[model samples]
Target: MIVGIDLGTTNSLVAVWRDEAPQLVPNVLGSVLTPSVVGLDDQGQVLVGQAARERLQTHPQLTAALFKRHMGSAQEIALGKRKFRPEELSALVLRSLKEDVERAFGEPVEEAVISVPAYFSDAQRKATRIAGELAGLKVEKLVNEPTAAALAYGVHQKDKETSFLVFDLGGGTFDVSILELFEGVMEVRASAGDNFLGGEDFDTALIQHFVSSQRQDKHFPDVNVPGMRNRLRCEAERVRHALGQQPTATFSLAQGGRQWELAISQDDLQHVSASLLERLRGPVERALRDARIRVADLNEVLLVGGTTRMPLIRKLATTLFGRFPAMHINPDEVVALGAAVQAALKQRAAALEEVVLTDVCPYTLGIETVEQFGRVLESGHYLPIIERNCVVPVSRVKTIQTLHDNQTHVLVKVFQGESRLVKDNIALGELSIPVPARPAGEVELDVRFTYDNNGILEAEVKVPASGEMHHLVIENNPGVLAPQEVRQRLAALAQLKVHPRDQMVNTTLVARLERLYQEHLGEVREMLGNMAGSFQQALASQDVECIAQMRESIAHRLDELERSPWQ
Candidate 1:
């Protein structure tokens, strides 16, 4: 079966179209939401989801989270003694979700439809597909998250004719999509967002507040330490969520027998997050302008992603549109459900025979060239072949002549973004096509860009005179892997020893104790060490009741010690 996966930054989920409707598939923990974290335990076994997240506090050096932000880059994150690319880390999460789907269906799942942020670049999209391959699944398609959400909403209201805005603010990325639905057809008019802006920025704001309040900047165990930062980030996440329902929440962190606490109000969160809120406005305005639809003309504004749960985000929407945005569907699950719907559509499911979906390229695709100004030839000009918001599965061509006589070859430098200058845009790839040398402005070559439904771009340069054609092949880009490298990486990932899911209860507690041991000193440190030893002995006995009792006793004691300061 082709399952749909939303490989998110903070959390991920899997869903399938069963019983003629989309249904979520729960993990071994019986929860559909899986924390997007990966780590290596003390046993040298890989840990994922909640288990890995717990280790982030206790074994920060061995755990990695938020790697999604580096998806299109060559940045390698260190987990203990080994380092891994973002795609590889994402592959581990996908593999875990793949297991969940198989367990739910009592069968193997080999193909999937994965969802990505609407504003993800071409290289990022390719990296996502490579991640799927590494996870032992065929990537059937890459659906834009907002487009998927709209498709899910459109399928339910098949006959409704309306134009709406999709405001998606997730853990690590933000996207604004404008769409129109009519007669069972959903069309994306425009898409815009900052790949770097998201809910995590709010967490950073909260972290800064606690840092300044506590004056921990000069502490012996500096707050900048990985373990300390993880502890603070975890507490900040809680306080941020709590402020959504209450006016005030306390941010607390414990280390070296001392507890630091700060009570913050919702107003404080808004004030600190003011700059981030402003970043949201530019994308919204740009999308609307590109779609040529006025805010008043929009039939509705649909909110998607878990970050939208914050009252502050919702309030911003209300102020911008003069009406509260619709949240009829669960923001976190909506995209996954939509992805499942897309998967079913790809299967040509009878229930979705009437539904037709379409999406647009989120950024402009062009090449760098020189423009003549009087007698001087100025370089670095960007000539767009395919403009942003153009419907996908699109092919656009532009013709240009040789810059100077005896120019035996034409170089095509491909780029993506809205910048008028090539220097300001993202370089995808480049190719040099040999041409018959001719006088200046005489040898014309045709450059064509074909953007497929999956958002992968292909560039071709053709010499009409000689009928010679060259295709752009991207190389040396750290984000993209060649066919041979992909095979090697796949084999490398297969050799990792993953910890069994059933052992997470024991493993998580041990990880927590290790974290506590490092945070304490004197008698407390020795006591925690002994307590961890006792729990290991209980596990070795293979007595269920004994292990349970020991686990409970240690857990309670740890909680008590964490809450109370010690001398």
Candidate 2:
């Protein structure tokens, strides 16, 4: 089986290739969406998905959902005496996905091409690939989510010259990808996104709205209270959904010995959400700016995600681009569908010939030069030599003269970002090029950057005078692991004993939990069943609650089940 996983920050989903069709694997609950959350059981067992998410709502400090945002950071979250890197935690999610897909197909599936946001950094991208390895999956390819969505949407349109912008508002990340479809080839010109923004922002906006409503309308104290944050978030999401169509919607919460209700207007929501919307403007503008296509030139705008259902988003996108976005596939499924389509193509050679795609580096990639001047001489500058929207299978060369006299070695620090300062950009790696000892401006150096179909950046610094050249690859990044270290670690990882304690307990635990929730579905409904039924179903079926309904239901039951092991 070939699988496609959208390893999102807030949610993780698994899709499989079956008989030429990409089918989403429904969890035990018979649903597709899974919450990317995990918690620990009383017996030091790992819990994943919905149950894990529920633990976050009831036990906020213990469970984590948006760890994907912390991928490149030096942070750690400990659970049950085990310290986990973000990559490890993410690996567990992928492991669970692998397990569920195997159960659905009753076949072994090893290779997968997971999707990532277009704006992921080199460190982040490497970390993501590592997470895949830890989960025991061979990453066939890593495709950007927005570009995947473009493939799905582009195929439906017969217009040979259509250009579109894919506005993807996911659970924890937001991306805008501009693509042009020509002669069955979908080429991505520019992609931009905010890893920190998404449906969560709207939740924050709703929180602020409620905070004000409490202060003025109901005259309650500040909105902070035990369990109140979760209630506020839930109601905020509710109000956001309802206000999308209705002029107003009611939001009510019970906390601190009181029940508060709010009838929020759409205008109020748009106002409260203005700050969040303002943040999106930069990404949108940057994507279009890089694509070099005017909003007026775009034939259509493709909207992806449940959040795009918001009236403000459609309004803003239409206002900015002069065209209302099109939603051919379910916004929630467009990216996943695109992923499935790609996975299918990968399995069959015949399909590969029919499908051709071009994707670009979502952010600017540069190298730090001498001094604190942060000169990005290669592919990063005021005007990139290759240009953002240029056709791919392309190489661009930058010429730099020797800065100092008798400089034999030049240190080039490659970075990635749109920031104007060195401190603001991501330092990808460094390269040292040897030149014939010469005076200032005597030697000519050519820095060639070649980006291929996979979005992999290969750079070589050449000294024409001395005929010396040095090259750098993502894995060859200094101080990370010098190839030899990785081999040693993998050798070490083989003997590390990752607690493969047989599924005797895992199976029993899974079956018992499934049986309990299957019998009394309300345990999930009232607890997490508050969300859509299909979403909740996925939660109830996992060793971890991977959905809201599943999280709440499983966490509640687990709590009750924990109080009496003898029962």
Highest TM-score scorer: 1
Cα lDDT tens digits for candidate 1, 451-561: 999999998888897899888897556789888988999998999999997777788788779877765677988999999999999999999999989988998999898
**Each candidate: what lDDT?**
0.90, 0.69
Candidate 1 has a TM-score of 0.94
Query: Which runs in model 1 stand beyond 4 Å of their true positions?
Result: 512-537, 545-567
Clashing pairs in 1: none
Model 2 misplaced stretches (Cα beyond 4 Å) = 158-161, 212-235, 250-253, 259-262, 349-352, 370-387, 419-424, 434-436, 465-467, 473-567
TM-score of each: 0.94, 0.78
